[model samples]
Target: MLRITTLLLILVAISSCSNKKTETEPLTAEHKAKIVGLSKDLIKSINDFDFSIVNSTWSNKAFKDRVSNITGTQKSVFEHIFEKDLKRKIKTGNLSIIHHINSTNGAASFFNLDHKDHHSELTILLTYNDNFNFFKYRIEIENQKPVLSDSYNFRDNLWYSEKIINSLRLASKHNAFSNDRRETNIAIHNSDQELLKGDTLEALYYLYDIPTTHQTGNWLSFRKLTLAQSLSDSVYASVMVTEYENNKSLYMKYLYHLYFSDSTDLEKVYDILSEELGESKTLDSLVSSGSFWD
Candidate 1:
């Protein structure tokens, strides 16, 4: 019995030690350096419009499987498509890595690539795997990109209006709208005014202020609040909004469709509001106060 007890204690100690190691072990400087070097090389390749480097940067099995699943195309055909896409990006200009976050197994790097006209910028996110191999990336374009905006000038406004209307309607169905209807009406009216004035970000905030019962999850309210707050700096809005949209949480998707749909009309009031509200406040406080609508 004594020997058995000692063995059990020893096993427990070993397990505790293993857990501590895992919990405390952070990515080493060497690992971070490796990730940074890999990221630089990948960005350089992209700027040079050399798709061949992808053959080395990407894990062959993973890339091949993903492309096959998505397009039902063989590796050669997918490479051709990828090359075309890279060429288009090259036309924009060289890409520069601006920020990165490294993890034990991988890293995510943010890049800013200038537009062809050099007037605007596009943000790209590259996600790598444990092997320091890139497996995915997302490029966010301006909503007013020539191809989409030229053909449909007012599409963004229309989309925003529709979303607000639909969300309000849903809230009503759930009896989430307040009895006074004053707040709800004000929200709709203010949003409309901002939309017409081309202050898209403020318009979104007005729509965000409509109070809903907590039981209903107030999904739209939370989503729009997050979006409005993030849009305080319109230059980084696309990247921030895209990251939230891609978040695995289903509630986060409510505002995903709002991004890259139109050019934001700059609002001077954004700075004032951001300052007044205290930019670092948690999302819950922002939603509860409803000061943004005021």
Candidate 2:
């Protein structure tokens, strides 16, 4: 009787541990289905030029700080520019022209999801009319609803975090310890605005002239490389590659180098990029048209 009681207790403990493991598992099929549905709805809303869905998902702080500037009724430098441009394009029926170029209707292809505690990350291969880009969202559960805290855009082996803090930082009147740094930051911001407005050459030359002491970041140098690539100025791109030696994506650097190489080299690079990106036709169109935006 004593032996049987001991064995029973051990069995119960094992069962309890198994139950705990199940409870902590990141995502079950049902949760995944719900998340995917949310993602699809977000994409559809964007395609229709309804930004409400995008705004609705923003975390409390992101919503308050990202859409408007520090001053009253002044729109964010980043959001205002892009949102206005997108709305204009939609109104002018320019989306159809872009779609014709890519031969693809904008679609959301779910790539990955990682869940931890009340936080989750979702990465999707998003086709935004003319571009195939990766959209990654950092989501957190608040009031039992998923809200976006931040997002990162991955394009052509370069990464851009859509930071709302730039507006606040730029608006602040406080002087930095180094005046040179402050001026450089302002110059870079202006250059970014030009790039957003499609003044590629102006943006490239302006950024290129910043003093090396203040332009120490690899991202700054990489930005020049992208602009040069867009303009098909391989000579300038080669110079940028030397400055931006620590870029995370070596293959992307190689692709840029080969983009203006001999025909055989171009073919080989295209095959490698297509295999890696999984969007051969879209890439081909973008390259052929010589209008790859950052």
Candidate 3:
């Protein structure tokens, strides 16, 4: 009887543990609801140009910490550059009013909850009238609240985290180029930063002041082409297409054209591009997406 009682107690304890594990195993529906709601709020903030609300939803501190870990103590400097330059540009009306948040949610995934770090990757389709773009956000839990930690735009094919780090590295190199070219570097960095924000025209405005000599490159040409394509400026896009096609340098290739060099790889790149960019305004299938890594 004693042995049977001990066995029964152990069994009960084991069952309780199993149930507890099961409870936390799946992403709770409540958590999913919170994430979806948070996404909508973020989109609204961006559309409204309320950087205060945008700042609240994003963990810039978390971003800085991550950047510090990777780039080593340059977070403050990078943040300063971003704030000063981008703000000045906005005040001057270079950046356009971001359009509405017309989006259709896609897949959402949850990962690394045990570490108290929740990576909620949500893919969604963002439409601006007839043109469509794919955007993905990686929402993470920081301080018991959900915040956007990183984002990836299908157009750029690069995450914002990567964009900032790269921008910081280049922008901080004061001796890398002459003063004029240094300004160009800053402008290029600013342009790519705007691209991350889904502002094609403002991004182009940053690039516009770049010296004519610095303007010609496979990467720059392709960047302009995609931005032009997004705005449906056929004439500008045609000029960019010509420049992109005629460029011979193999050095600094856009990710979009990297695959097109070979037949087998081209097919794979095509399928993914088609899916991400959707069918409308595909430049007649010549160029479906309209952004690239800088």
**Could you say which candidate leads in lDDT?**
2
Tens digit of lDDT per residue, candidate 2, span 218-282? Answer: 46656777677678766475655565364434345544555445567556756775664455676
Best by TM-score: 2
Candidate 1 regions off by >4 Å? Answer: 23-35, 45-251, 254-294
Better of 1 and 3 by lDDT: 3
Q: Quick one: ranking by TM-score, best first?
A: 2, 3, 1
Question: Model 3 off-target regions past 4 Å?
Answer: 1-33, 40-55, 68-73, 82-117, 172-219, 222-270, 274-294
| Per-residue C-alpha lDDT of model 1 across residues 46-163, encoded as one tens digit per residue | 5444544443433322222222222112223445644666334422322222122222322333343322321222232333331211122211122211111110001121222133
Worst 10 residues of 3 by lDDT: 106-115
Poorest 10 consecutive residues of model 2 by lDDT?
Answer: 17-26
RMSD (Å) per prediction: 20.2, 13.9, 15.0
Better of 1 and 2 by TM-score: 2
Report, for every candidate in turn, its global Cα lDDT versus the true structure.
0.38, 0.54, 0.53
| All candidates: TM-score | 0.22, 0.48, 0.48
Which ranking of candidates, highest lDDT first? 2, 3, 1
Could you give candidate 3's per-residue lDDT for residues 50-164 as a string of tens digits? 5554456666555444443333335556667657773344223211223334132212222112222245666544444334445666666665566665566554566666666
Give the Å shift of residue 65 in candidate 2.
Answer: 12
- Model 2, TM vs. native: 0.48
